[model samples]
Target chain A: MQALVIVAHGSHLNPDSSAPTHAHADTIRSTGAFDEVKTGFWKEEPSLREVLRTVESEEVFVIPLFVSEGYFTEQVIPRELRLDGWDVSAWDSDGLSADTATLVAEDTGQTVHYCGPVGTHEAMTDVLVRRAETVTGDPEVGDGFGLAVVGHGTERNENSAKAIEYHAERVRAMDRFEEVQALYMDEEPEVDDVTEYFESEDVVVVPLFIADGFHTQEDIPEDMGLTDDYRTGYDVPSEVDGHRIWYAGAVGTEGLMADVILERAADAGADIESAIATVREATRKTEADGEPGKTDTDREPRETDTDGETQAAGD
Target chain B: MTDVQATAVDVRDEQVDALLKRLGSNDGPIEFDGLSAATDADGYALSTPESGDHRGLSEAEFRAAATEDGVAPYVTNWHYWEETVGHRGRHRRAFLRRAEAADERSVPARYVDLDSGMETEWGEVVVTATLGENGDRRYEIRHADDVGAAEDELDGYDDPLDARQIATDDDRGRYRPLKSAPTLISGWIFENLGGRDAVETLDVLYPASVANWNLEREDELDVTHWRETAERQTGIYDIIEDLPREAVEWVAEACCVDSQCLKRREWQYDEGDDLAADNGAGAFPCREPCSLVVAAARKWTKLEEEETHTYEFELTPSEKEQVEAIVDAVADGRIDEIREADVYEGANRYRTRFLRAKRFDEDGSLSGTPTDPTDEN
Candidate 1:
């Protein structure tokens, strides 16, 4: 059985930050398409190192549940999981030789597969559009309405801003609103700057963030000079100077995120038969040099190891 | 009783005579001028006999001062009253009486608009008062516009004492509740991470353990076991468990080995080196890794309980595709960035996908591996 572990950047402060990831993990696990579906966080309990230790699967796929391809996705998760030069030869079940195995190895062989962040999947565009529409009530390309896609952009990673730009471009292509633009909290063409970019008199500001925390509440409003009473009604315009702006809640608030996550899993390698076939082929090649009739591919009988010291079958 | 009465009467005559002389000399209208002169002279403005200030003076004296002497005479000759009461007494009394009747009565309320005053829906009002119940006493208040309007709306009572109480009560009611963000966040950390003691330990040791630095104290010759024990109890592991996953990841990235500030130590194996002889030499190299393990365990346990569950496995290819499409859209930032045409497309896609996934088998029979994912399960 295969296992997928979705790792998230949790918070020591805000429970809402980790809530969506946890919900998505539940959805994946409930489907029961894999042997295991777990979640791990960097800040909260179950530290990255502990997650590697606790993961029992011989072959576990790690998926970063982040919004961008930043430091955590690029450097931190890999380091924590010790993915460098790790080998999985001992855990291989199909009696395959080392040369025939497709598994990558390090000096100290530990087996693990690290996938790209779930945020990098193509399906996230739907979430952004849906959120924008729900907030602005105009999901079509036309005159009068404006869309501002706001992201938590930092100076640390230029690629992080790409997710926002990608979504903005897609939105602009649809031409549903009179205008669609991308903005950030940190980088240039900030949320305030994008306010001027919109062609329409009215704009809907949607935060492409996972939680309704400081950035969404304090920073965004501070930059925009929003008073406490602003954005009380969905249709009513939040007047800044003469321009009317409306705000939607953060993108993470959408309930359909669970579906999105499951869809990502399917897109990654969800076809059970295909995945099994691939593993089998790899196992067979590795086993070609071993004893002819002795294949380790068969599932072990339930009660063979009475001493509770069962050895893993080698491929 | 006779001795007490004689003393009270004498005090009342003396006070009334002085006040009458002050009022007789003042120039303004009787009500306004008398009070103003009395306030200007003695710093002891007179209210109706029912006022709290009335109780401060001898009853006989207050009665005589207000009735027999009358208010107008005091208004006319206010300086004489000031001479009798003392230099600052008149100003103090004026402010106190104004503060007392600010809600119910239209007394000339003394106020100072400060920069840090409150903000109200209506207009702002700033009030500062110096009280002299028996002698000279003072208190200051600066309210926001909303509070000022609220204060203005209060009903005026006939008695000054009742008016004072009413004003005080209104002021208290108008005070905004203290912002609870800090307390709420702290409490959340404490409750989630076991308790205050556990949280305190984590706060202390988190920097040292996560950053791989030794903590130094001013008093100790060397770091002792008790301090170590404290640090261990409050380790980064415990701190992480209290946090949500995203915060954990952010902090770890900011502080751990991958951080910009981290100093990487390269290992060189020499012949006959026992350190290099063991395959597990680098395992648990520092407290940082151990703390990380603890943090990961807590996070894992939490996620296991929150995420994994049983469901039936009966989804059509189309349904699965729809789900996959939605997921892809989210991952690629398409759904999150849907524009005019894409908005409808994204919504339709999400709706179909969500419905299909929500329609798992009624029996709750999951098709994947046998291991129960959730600890509760």
Candidate 2:
């Protein structure tokens, strides 16, 4: 059986942090691409340490639904997931090639392919560009709009700003937008002074974040002077300090993310065809049985050593 | 000793088929935990015992339905429960079995309720479990206040994470510092969550109540006594360790009691030195001094630094007892229970207001004696 595990940094304080991950998992599950689709959280239940244990699949693809490859992708996740032979120090030099790197559990023998964070994917450029144009209801955002790709930067990890910068450069290369700039919540050219970084009066700020929580909903908007009260709904193209700002939702919450996750798995050397085929076969067999739950698989009897020790489903 | 031992994976299908065979021959519908299975002329049916309603499936359908995604619910839920409450060198399997009422119940004797519908409480949240059409466990979490409220009358949430919002604040829109505080607002329900999702919902509502309860039941709870917990404090909290031994009991009485927090206080002055205050009667145990208690202790430590003073004040005997009663009422969170019409109740808002009006002077002093010598009043 093939399984997909989507890992995200869930919050103990804010429940919304894990919303996008669960949404994407539901979407992926509906497609029936894998035998099982489960979610793991760094902060919530079914934690990274135990998420793999829940899956009975032999072949598993684990994707990090993060906005960037940084301390989490480099260190915490590997340690928690117990990905054997992962050199934390080799992340930059070795590039941590997702396709070549296969994590096989010492005990479970589950062949796990750990994929890259979805944020750094090439498809994210499309998502960011799409968000910028759609939020303004202007396909011609390239004509006058200045795009600011915002990230929650930290002094702790230099790699945190790489994804935003990469997307900004990609958008700039497209030459669609008048100007594209990388902004951060904590670093210089911060989201607070977003208007200063753009020459165009029409500025579009897109948060390159996985979850639409406190930073995207409250702090960034408050800093941009778009909304005084975070509780009340704010409109797009809100007049902030005499500048027309169209603030899109977090990039991670995009519907296209479900497709991006599948792409990431494929790129990481996951046998997508085999996974899909397994699920399809089971579904087909169930359908052929003239009912949803019926299958034609043969059942072998018990081996009987300690058969009377405990009840079914017991330890 | 190279004995051939077949793994669970190798024997899962056989076990499921064996259980299905037994289910087919049952004299009538047999119920275990929340699951009910029986055979009829058409096929076999597995459903919730409480509802006793389900669409029957053929033998093939029953076997196929038992396993979701090539992983049997029995296996998945077994490993899930074992990892959840059985890890960390703890032994609450018996308690968990009893909680789900799976103890002494076997497959031939009865079918394993993989996702059994059970009702349990974690602090102020009432968790109700039921079975789905396919015999999957579904859970509904709501405030204890809305226990009997109709579904339409209360707001409904499908996402288990929505419990965070409901658990964050009280009915009055005030932030609750304690997640397990009795002030949880009502009128919201997280309906029809899966087994794992239900546990996650409960965790969001009350953090580690289930895990802590399991640890307590296993007698593996690690309780950090007052001195040990306090001595490790730094900065502003370091003063907590300087508090007199007797004052530690006051902190427990004020902060660790059942009326203040839901967790039963297991910590004491030290290992063997017990506090005079009552440890709470909560279903879960408090393993250590919580951050709230530590913060409160810091404030009390500062207050305890003040020297005692004697001031002369003329007050009637009944008035003195009324003053004490007012403090007691507020401390016990029973001020809302006192009605204005109950004039005789010392803590009644109107009665207290009248007392203040009569006793307080222009400077807001009690009976014209300054309420505090340090203050201008």
Candidate 3:
């Protein structure tokens, strides 16, 4: 049996940050695309190496649920997987691209197909479009609202900004927004400056992040003055200067990305029917993995000695 | 209640302009006049009742004199608004009554802009705007009666230098003005931090712990997220690995201060350094809250449930350097070169085990011997 493993940057403080990642994993698992689907994280347990070891299948797929091809993808995740390979000399000064699943597979010596980050996929724009519509209900209604696509752009790399700018352009092309602008928390053309681009009474700022982690949940909304009370991903509409700002869930957490996950898995030769349509057509948004019950780990066998003990996701 | 009773709403200085604009739209842009020094002083008191003899006492002065919370004096900015048409006492009483009748949230009150020229049920009104000590805007309500011996004689010291000197203490980190506001969660109260204690006192720990003045997230983010994010922002790695899991809770239960200045590892002269200087740097349970201490506390819960991999190596400093270089290369994507180049038996072995970073198998082999990779299975 083949397997699929997804890597996410989990949070110790906020349970909601990693909830979407686990939810999407469960969604893909239902499709039975691979022999098994496992989720690993930098912060939370079942660590990456643990995920690789515990998968019953020898052939596995490692998918990064990341926003862009940055440090975590290039350096941290590869190092964690031992993908740069065993021969110490084989690992050199220049690290591999984390998004390049092919290179990671070659170095790790595992029968794994590495997939591109979910954020870089053509299908993600659809997820973002849907996230905006969930808040405004219709594209025409969104036209009266300024769409501020907030991204975490680093001054060190321009690629991160390019990815966000790409989405803003695509969304703008659809003409659903009265005004479309790209803003960053770290870089210039900041989210604070987003208001300058709009004279509209209403603005819908959709955070283009992979999960409901730090930036999406707090920083973006606080900077934009979108809400006083912010949960992990979704927040109710807040009023500022008579302008209504509808805060949406992260684009990465959209169920459509699960199809993107399977597509990436399929591209990497996970023998399963490709459900690309699910990603394209997926509209139902969720703040939870399934329902508000005990986590899968709590019910499923709580990891054996061979595998690390599994705890619940929120913990 | 008498028409002379005073009230306050803890609002952010930035929001005050819009709030003022909203409250005084009927009076046009209010023409402000007040006594406050612009030099070495920064404060803003928006409005006060124009009825009394000493009506010019800034809101800061009133709060300073009345409260036991040790309120800070130097407010960078603030906003105050009072009635012009109706008697100040009756209007405030009516507003409070109306607010209590409708929504009972200490009223993030929305003032109706009664046109100055026209007389409504309330009465004829005039609203004036002025700049405060810190250059923050202030609005005054001056109605039909020209009370208090002309505008210049009372609180109307247009030039800050002309106003009577008011006493202000070392209140830099204190969010004093909003301490007495009926509403618990005001943007100004949360946004303007009086260290960690003030924020944490209201039981908003998550926001306080994660508050980063440098990142501009302090006003908004609670204590919950500070630790999860500290490692990245501070570039201080191994926060969990370096500190033991069991001790994280003890600090919070023990000598934990509200401001969290104690746990901050970003400063060279932090509480950790001042308290217990071990590990070439001390550990948690500092006098103030800091990112390091907070991160450790947050990490403790996960650490307890974690099934971590361990790798022990007693390598020389040079050997360790080589190992880091190799790991960096592997992490950097220079795998083929390292494989083709000189493979030091020690470095290779160390690389294999360390590459696992105490996160992989306990007895996993350094040598790639012919055995099933899924031997565990």
Candidate 4:
């Protein structure tokens, strides 16, 4: 049996920060493509380390739901999920390439498959365009609207801006709208300066983000002068500086990502039939022999210090 | 790399002129409006600082004229010392401070009410004039007895209590301390203060003050400093320019963005890259994990700049279970219970299993980091 885990950057302040991640996980679970599909977050419940232990399957697929190959993807996610391309517990596992699809667990024979982030997938470009079109009404119209793909670009790294720029290019190439602009909250070609990239008065700004948190909800709208209300709460087709600005929600939250998740799972070469059989056998065994999902190894650490972050044995 | 310079200007010409004239001569209180000169120290008598002729009034005479008008809590006008340097309505300023102390216990009722009138919101009651935490008169209220106050109010019942017209601390309004005319940065010169480029960079970074101020130029004009002068005077934000660019880069570049996502914002503003780079923890503004570097550290162990060696060993199903127990034990801080833990061949591999189990890649390598500002963390 195998399980799928979707990882996201969750917020401690906004409760809705990880909602889409959880929603997508639930949507995948309903299809039963894998024995289990769990969601883990950095700042919220079910941390990556904790989620890894919940898998009863012999394999697990870890998919990052981020929009780019920046810090979290290059450094944080790999570090958190222990996907640094080496498994010292397994001989010769040290030099495996970072893009390697599979690795056998040294102790449990559990194979872990790492997949690319959902944002980097080729399918995401279309998702971004679709998100924009929702606000613009239709792309087939003769009077097309301008589109701006806004990202939380930074001065510390260039790849952050590049992700949005890449998508903006893809969206631009579609030529469905009069203009396509890639804007950032921090870096150059700022969201506030989106007017420079487009000639049309009716513009659509789609947030190229994984979640509807601060950058998507508060900062961009404020900078772009779309509306005073945060996170698309107010009416769209709102006029700003004589231009009708139509704002769309973050690209990652679209329901279409369910297909992308499955595609990533398939990219990992998960054998659904075998996993299904294994899950059935395990269930039968649990009922027949009373060998529930309990194991001494599943026990949480016993902490000497009561105040330590040591977790409970089971959630 | 050039040093970060300071652009702050010190004493302004108008302020200096005002300071000097007040200290240079006494502006006597006199009767005005075509009134005959009265022997009594009369209230409401209009007077102006008649330059040079003010030299006739003695300090004692000025005080007598001002005191006869009155001292705080009951005073109508405090223009006597208002013209003095830095100290305006000194008695009333002290009075407001005492009234705000919750523990002080002995304040006039009107002053106690005035304190509440300063901050936050209250119902239906109209607030004309209110003080501030600092000594800023925040509003220009028409405090005529029959001005804005309502029928049952203190005086001049018109729009609520028409408080007195005065100064303000409103940033968008005139008279904001930082937005004063001529931009009040100090001008105390410091030789070799990081030179031209440094000061220019400081000018860009510091939100206050401009650059190239010279004391010699001021002294060349035959102006003399009775007290210690400043190297450069500046608004409160001037100090930020003095910090190393990297230390304050996040502040300037920050978008108030919330995410744990890291992006490339490679800034070349490090004109002083010759200095030691900041490999230490940067700012973490996100309450939840932002895409920023610091927030990524919350859960992403790969982002953690640490060293770890990998060890792999095959374990039987039961042996794997034992490793899990040991890992769990160690994680729960129950290591003592695992004293005999290595009974399994994978016992030595427990810590390694912990990382693998925790989701690290095969190599204990956290080296996939793509871009950085200083090439340090």
Candidate 5:
């Protein structure tokens, strides 16, 4: 049976960050989709290194529950899991890729699959749009006030801002509001400075964050100079310099977030069969080449195959 | 990196050695900030030498300063010695030793209790104590495990006894510390309670006790003894009610053992292991196998008392279609159909799966034979 491991960047200080992951695990377990659905954390107990030891599934699929693909996804997780390379194909009967099998002969004999971060999924836009509508109280984008997409921009990556801007454009194209603008917390046109740039009389500020943490409570409020509770349609009128501004909870906290994660997991599973086929083909190709010690290297290592099985090295 | 600027650097072996000697002779506590200011005026001065553009002072200069005086140049760097020596050095070492000691100690058992004066229904309690002049007098009650014992033991000694000598004839058989003559001293009880609202309640309790004790003060009576005894009695009463019955017995035995061990100023095997055994194995009731009983009770209580909301959201047409396809495939026992379901809309992509039902019997055998089986001759 396959095991589904949801890895989250849990917090020791805040109990809310892990809530959604736990909720998703509970929902999946209730349906009995997989033999086991466990949660591991980068910060909390049952860390990434110990995740495999805690479970007994023959095949394991790790889904990173992060909002973005960065250091944690690229370096930290790979290092912790002790994965050397990726394969776009399926594994041999020995349950190891040709190369990995030779590198570590005394293996655990279990197939491990790692799924990309859930944030990369397009279904997440639904979650964002829903959060935007909730903030504006408008079913359609053009029916109500302007929408503002708030993102955490850093000096290190320009692409991060581009991704948020792309999502904002999609929301704007729906014609759901009087206007839609992209704003950042760190980079140029900060949340406060950009609030005035909106042409609409009523502004709805939506935080594009995965967790309602320090940024949502302290930094955002301090920057916005807001003291009153802000929600959908409940505007906190700020008379500072004769401008009206309002705010809303983080987009990640929308009610249907768990649904989006479930959808992504299912999508990853759908591609597993093809991924397994690729692995088999790659293995056969390597064997036919007649190269001594040559390993299966044709297939690329993907998070999941078309059939939802993790592909082995060589497709 | 540029080559070590040869012209800008200078070597003055004699001047540096003299400065080192002067620094060593100075017995007063070294102050770096003050010395840095003094040396800043002259780039490489022993005592007020001419200013130069060279890197203020090198390691050799500082070393020379220390040796100038009789004191050994134990410190190679003057700035480092000034910052770390004397009171600051002592304090740093003390803090490190304390941390090391704490790490060596065993991890304490944590317990939750609601008896603390916090308004909340549940709060945590922690207790720690040290032995008195008598080695056996050491007794501690951790609120987590020994709440009951703490209360009962504390209550037993709450009364204010008179400073009376036991009659020699009556005390003949007993071995008492105050056997021949008796002396009296005042005793006070100090209790620390913690919780969400403990601070507020503590404020009220402390002030009221102080005022009440002061009001009762009178001539000819030892006010200190009276106040101490009264406070101890009240504290004992409070703890007695807060602890469980089992805790009471444990505390009594612990107190007796503590008193005996304390008098000798040496640890007894039995007394030392009593606390260890209580904490490690004997304190809490066995919770294995039967722990389900407690869990069920808790769940039932929560279900009856708690309120839950069944929140729902409207799925978009595409979302509905995707969910239906996956659900239908699972229900139809078409694992491949369900596994192939994928939804891609712009950058929003979703993968779905419908679970396959499990078969109970080995080799996929049927539980019951078919009712209508036709045989051909």
Candidate 6:
């Protein structure tokens, strides 16, 4: 059996933090790729601590829907998920990837193959670039527009800006945009001074954030001179400092994020085929046993072919 | 490909077997919220008592049936969490589960009394349970004010997370520091949610309310009293520890009462020393001093540091009573409830404005008496 558990930083105060997570879950659920798909949150219900108890599947793929590898992805999530054999103290400078992040629990026998965060995924670079073009309504935004990728960076963890830097470097290499620079919220080249670094008059700032919470909604807009009042969903191309500043929503809220999440799961060797097959076999067996065919209401994981009879005689 | 290391555990089959064992030994039928499990001569029979409809299946068929409608897993998993997991707040879970299942009314029971929807109130929100296919339950959550309001009339939301926005503010869009305040806005409904999802939605709506309420029911609510909580403060808030025993009762009366907050005041002056202030009669208990209360107390503590000087303000007996009435009205959060045209009411907006206009000198003061006579305005 297989399951995909997307762990996100949900907020009790700001529901928008968890909105993208729910949207992505719903989108992925419609695809019918895995036997089960569930979301665990840091600040919401079915928390990271007890989310594992709800999953009946043995082979689970846990993905962090974060911007990049940092304190939460490295320490808090691993500790909360109770990745039994993982050495969370070792902060790998190279950052998390599909190959280097798997952890196996010796007690529950549940193999949790940890996947890299969605933001650091190779596909995110394209999503960021597309956001700049889409928000400006110009397909050739790279020709004259100065694109600034904003990341919520802190001096505490340098790795928080790694994903934004990675995307910036990749987009810059494409030579499509006239200027592509990475800006941080807390660190130097701050989002507050976004227009000063760019040579172009029309600048497009896209927040490389997972959700449109405090940073994306209020802070970025205020810092970028889009609005004096703290608010969300600003009208693009607002004149700020004698320049047209086109702001886009957080990159994680993009609908294409469902593809990136699935890609991360597949890259981590989620074995979705086996999970899909297990459900198909369960449905076939139930139908052959003269039980009603599978329905949309049937979401629970079924017993494997070998366990049905053995289960009745176990105790 | 990622490396694989795992041992298989068939949890679903085991859950089915546990239910089977319970079914086999039962005198009649083991009844849960809506469905009933009974053992027959051939194998096992699961039925809805309200509908008088039953279905028989073999042990293997039962295992297969577990995944069909999720009822088998739902019952077994609930039992698993209750028994083997040593789950905390058993009473809370049971109470919430029964409430989610629509209490005594089943799906068919709702069909019989169609207009009389199976509804229950959690804080200010009204939850209505509706029947789905094959004994499945779907819940609708709305503000209690808009209980029977038309569906289209309200902004419908399917995501439970949207409750945060609804509960974040009052009708005037003012941020509600206290979540359970009676000022919840109407005209919104969470269309349909499953049992677990409904409970989860409520958890988002009223953060940790169910868990805390559960802890209270289990006699495991660890309450941190005012003195103990105040003593642990650091920085500027450290002055709160110096507040007198009599003043602590003022803090309780000001912040912890039902008028100020929805949570019942569980904390007292100390464990053995109870305050004279009336404990709030809210359904849920406040286990500790909230941050708002602590912040207010900090400000009050600073104000208490100032030397007291009784300044004389000559006024009639009715005017004195009116001044007392204004303080009482503001403390009880009833300033808005008093009408503007109701001049007879001492705390009425027009009456208060008239009092301010009549009593003050060029500077805003009562009967030309300065608070601090050392400085002239």
Ten consecutive residues with minimal summed lDDT in candidate 5 chain A?
A: A306-315
Per-residue alpha-carbon lDDT of model 3 for B82-175, expressed as tens digits?
A: 2221222222222322212212311111121111111111111122322333223233333224323354443332221111011011123222
Off by over 4 Å in 6: A1-127, A138-140, A151-167, A173-175, A184-196, A208-235, A238-243, A249-315, B1-97, B100-120, B125-169, B175-179, B186-201, B207-324, B355-377
User: DockQ: which is higher, 1 or 2?
Assistant: 2
lDDT tens digits, residues A1-315, model 4?
778988886653444556678667766776677876766665553444334543446678878787655445554555555554543332222211123256654323357786766765656776676555444445342155788888776564455566677777877787777888888877778888776677899888888777665566666767777656553345566677778777776777665566566666766676554433333232221123322322111111111221111011010
Residue lDDT tens for model 5, A131-174: 54444344343454677777777554444465567678877787
lDDT of 2 at B136: 32
Off by over 4 Å in 3: A84-99, A103-109, A139-142, A228-235, A271-273, A279-315, B1-377
Please identify model 1 stretches exceeding 4 Å from their true place. Answer: A86-111, A136-144, A228-237, A272-315, B1-377
| Candidate 5: segments with Cα more than 4 A from true spot | A86-109, A136-142, A228-246, A270-315, B1-377
lDDT of 1 at B258: 21
Backbone-clash count (model 1)? 102
lDDT of 4 at A156: 44
Supply candidate 5's per-residue lDDT for B264. Answer: 12
The local distance difference test score of each candidate is 0.43, 0.66, 0.45, 0.43, 0.39, 0.67
Candidate 6 lDDT by residue in tens digits, A255-274: 56766777778777865544
Backbone clash count for every predicted candidate, in the order shown: 102, 1, 47, 62, 70, 2
lDDT of 4 by residue, B226-345 (tens): 010111212221232243334334432432211211111222234233223222221111111122222322223232334453544455566567657756656443554443446443
lDDT of 2 by residue, A194-246 (tens): 88888898888889888776667777877888777666557677887678888
lDDT of 1 by residue, B51-119 (tens): 223323343454454543223233222322244223332222322233334324321111111112211
RMSD of each: 33.1, 15.1, 26.9, 31.7, 32.8, 14.7
Worst 10 residues of 1 chain A by lDDT: A306-315
- Candidate 4 ranges beyond 4 A from true positions: A84-100, A104-109, A136-143, A228-233, A271-315, B1-377
Cα lDDT for residue B351, candidate 5: 46
